[model samples]
Target: MATILKRASKGKAGYGKIQFCGEQARRDGLQYFWVDTCCIDKSNACYVYLPDVSQSSSVLADNSNESWESFRKSEWFRRGWTLQELIAPASVDFFSREEVLLGNKTSLEQDICETTGIPATALRGSALSDFSVAERMSWTECRETTYKEDKAYSLLGIFDVYMPLIYGEGKDRALRRLREEIDKASRGTSLFKREDFSVSFSLSDVSDVEHFVARKIELVKIHKALGVDGSRRVVVLHGLGGIGKTQLTVAYAKRHKDDYSGIFWLNIKDENSLKQSFVKVAKQISREHPLALRLSNVDTNENLDDVVDAVKEWLSLLNNKRWLMIYDNYDSPKLPGKTDPTVVNIREFLPELY
Candidate 1:
């Protein structure tokens, strides 16, 4: 193993495995091949997972439960380094010791999670910060490292923090240093620090969430559309009136409430109702930020349009991203020759989303 490692490092050795990897890279139309001896940005790299599971005929014949259990119990899964390699990559192709193709990460996610006790969300590439520090730490409890200090050092990618590696620091000191760096990285660094379910939220109702059946496909679409790309995402739930559009939106908000800093709902049934909702939003903001009271001067003497403009400005604050705004009952978008008093131009009420 040490000789193989040495040959892999030099990239010019007579090792058959290294030559095979190079051939695979060429077959895939690539010039570079990276091994997981060290961590890089795995999100950008395709990881070829070579687990040391035997490809014996018995293991292959029946695809039996025992065979799968043996696959899960491979030494590769027990290594501390493989944890990040499994979770960080956007793509992973698994192969057995005999170079037989097994499956990809997405295809074999359930088996991997059963072995590792990692939630499918994290394995599916949800934000690491979406998980708590304790939960992230727990993923390493079962894995082992060669050197005691390496136990802590291997976790740098998991916590998304970095520290200089000192080989002789001992495991305790290394862990203490890792924890200190994690604390420093966490302090005031979040744009939205509100606890789960503690964000300033004004939604339709909680009662609807109880009876709501999961709209799995729609939810997945919403998540994919509004990916973590730091851009404005708008998802319109259009359907016949009274066909549970409101319920769907409510369910989405409640399910993903923690994913945002704030969740605000607007009643766009009509122009008058939209203005009233904006006034309510202004009041909500004023309670948190005293400075917002100046912008939202929502007195009877003040024009409603000014209040709307002020609330929009507050929502448009540069630092306040990850806010979920739902414009409900938008059945009366203004159009040519539409003289209805209830008609509204929703564009006027929307904030400039960054």
Candidate 2:
């Protein structure tokens, strides 16, 4: 590993890396390849000093009896330039001092975790975004960089954000900028589309999420189906009660409320509730939608069906606006019998969008 590192840092790129990378990219049907070591910006590079193991450091030798430290503490481990090389790659292979075939990061993860103090999942090359800010920061707790600015710059790929080089800025400010960029990235639109159900979304509703794990992957699939690609624009999650479907949706809304223009949760647990919720929602939609108020002529004599029909009409329109509607707890088609012409099933009230 040390020999290869030395050669990689040398003035000449003599390892046949260019041809090898080009061939590998071609085999993978890719247009190009990127090698960080080959194209490093030496202007922003950090240096590491390796010592001869056979001869101890003269300063340590001169002092009284002292314990020997292995090359694990070498500058290579501490240099800021090396952290990304260790982490950002999908997989990293390690070779012995004799250059014999050893193993890749996955094949020897336990040792890597014990040595580096990084979590096994991260060492296995999980997306940096999958881990929290604190978890990512802890990976570099003891690592070092020659320039204060490189400490933050080194983590650019880890956080998956790009900022202009500001070498003179102190480490604190640079790190601050890095975190700001990460926060901006975290705010990117998620698939959890929410409809305005006559009430503002409350994070408190999902505050009890400690006991419930986030079903983000499932929610993402549903989000993509309902929100993306402009096809199959409607989705229904049908299952027996107490299956965590509602909680999963609430968790998605709480986590990604900022991504959507609006979020609406309809309590279609029963027909009366569904109709009432729809009428209430129509009044709210009337403020923004041109057709809603005209259709919802809420005279004292107006029937409940009139309001529901008006609300459905407002929702079915094809517009540039984006919103998510959850027809929650739709366990049965039969509405709780109430008025003269009872609400029979869900198909009757739903919007008619293709």
Per-residue error (Å), model 2, residue 241: 55
lDDT of 1 at 268: 84
Task: Please give, for residues 1-354, the per-residue lDDT of candidate 1 as tens digits.
Answer: 344555466546335556556566677677667565743466455545454677665566787777777678888788888888888888777766666667777888889888888999988888888876656766776789999888888888888888999999887678778868876888887722332212366664323746768678988888788765547887777889877778877877778877887788888878888888878777766554432334524562468888888878877766566777888888877888988876787888889765
> For candidate 2, lDDT tens digit of each residue in 192-257?
122232223443422244688866689788767776343325687777787787788887777767
Which of the numbered candidates is closest to the native, going by highest TM-score?
A: 1
Candidate 1 versus the native: TM-score?
Answer: 0.49
Give the RMSD in angstroms, all C-alphas superposed, for model 1: 16.6
Off by over 4 Å in 1: 1-14, 46-51, 56-61, 191-354
Clashes of each: 0, 7
